[model samples]
Target: MKVAVFSDVQAVLPALEAVIEHIEAWHPDMVVMAGDLVNRGPDSGGCLALFDAMRREQGWLPVYGNHEVWVLRCGEEAPASEGERDIRRFTDLAWQQVADQAERLHGWPDHLCLHPPDADAWLHVTHGTMAGNRDGITPGRSDESLAGKLPQGVALFVSGHTHRAHQRRTQGMDVVNVGSVGSPFDGDVRGSYGRFTWRGGRWHTELVRFPYDRERAARDFETSGFLDQGGPLARIVYLEWERAELLIAGWRERYQDAVLRGEITLESSVERYLRTIT
Candidate 1:
């Protein structure tokens, strides 16, 4: 059996389309969307709609990522303070586009398990580790640290959220991070996915990367009103795509406290941060 998995579409329609086309050509027996199908970029509704159509027409499995949870929380709970409200305006913008499909989004599981026929072990797929959706399993993590993240009785574990693809075997199991379809933080602009083939009583994995129309994706940020309306945080998200590197963590570490404490305006902090980087 062949299985394909992808994650972190983050609302880049062009990248998603390229990955879908590649996966469809491979014609895997089963496909799983690991998670983070929306938010952090423009066109959350577009990405969700296409993924939903694939889920309905084909046998694609869906899982929810931390971004999905954040969008839902933005809908259910009000921001604690004015600073938070301003900081979370990007999520609020995404929520507006997807609020109508809250039931469907809510129904998505946090993780999934697949038992291949005649195989003694099962394959586990989640957006992150067993600890939480935001706590990712990366290549830099030690084997000792991974022991707590891996679930028992699984032959193959699949995940994505760090946006960097890697494969490792330890403690009698194989783990693969499928990477990102839209916003890869590994300095590679190409979209990525995971291809798993089950043969000879074991699973073989490959991390596939393909180029997409990134220029179109960049334009979508402005055209879709995400940059203009999604607040200062949205700009950081855009830079992440442009550079294919992680910036939010650094921005948060440097400016989140000041912004939250009302020491600096969100707009001003973002501008200052950008200057330092550029």
Candidate 2:
């Protein structure tokens, strides 16, 4: 069996387009989107539309990620403070883009289990781990720490959400983080995905990194109205795409409480955070 798995295509249309073209050329037997197919970056609606078409026309499978969950919750949750409202605007924009497809996204499963014909080994896929969709499995974690993250009796565990691709062995399971299709946080700007093959009674995996039109993708941050309407934190998200690294976590750590308390404005906090990065 030949399976292709990818995740974290956070609405960068160019990257997703390029990756899809490549995947079609590879012609895997099954294509699975682990999650985070929307939100962050730009062109969320376009991304959702493209993937939705694929799932319907091409039989592609999907697993919901934390971002999808957050998008759905946006309709039910009210912010406790203005600062939270500011921070949530990004998701709000995404929600507006994807609201028409809420029921479809809600139906997506959180995990996938596959059994290759005539093979003793089975495969599992999820956006993150059993702990939750936001809890990612990454290379920085120790093997012992990852043991609990893997489900038992599966020969291969596939996941994304860290946006850093890696292959590891823990608790007698082969684990793979397929990386990001839109903006990866591993300091590499290329789009990434996993190619898995079942042969010779075992599974072999490859992490494929492919370059796309980064300049065009960058232009989308403004052209798609994401930066203008996605609120104060949208610029930070654009920076993450440009830098291909994480800034939100550190930014929130340093400024969220201050912004919430009205000690510092959201714009001022963002400006201060920008100064810290190159």
- Which model scores highest in TM-score? 1
lDDT for each of the candidates?
Answer: 0.92, 0.90
Candidates' TM-scores?
0.97, 0.96
- lDDT per residue as tens, model 2, 159-227: 999999999888888999999999999999999999999998899999999999998987888887899
Q: How accurate is candidate 2 locally (lDDT)?
A: 0.90
> Which residue pairs of candidate 1 clash?
none
Model 2, position 192, has a per-residue lDDT of 99
Give the Cα error of residue 75 in candidate 1, in Å. Answer: 1.1
Once fitted onto the true fold, the runs of candidate 2 whose alpha carbons sit more than 4 angstroms away are: none
Model 1 segments more than 4 A misplaced: none
Cα displacement (angstroms), candidate 2, residue 35, comes to 0.5
Clashes (backbone N, CA, C under 3 Å), per candidate, total 0, 0
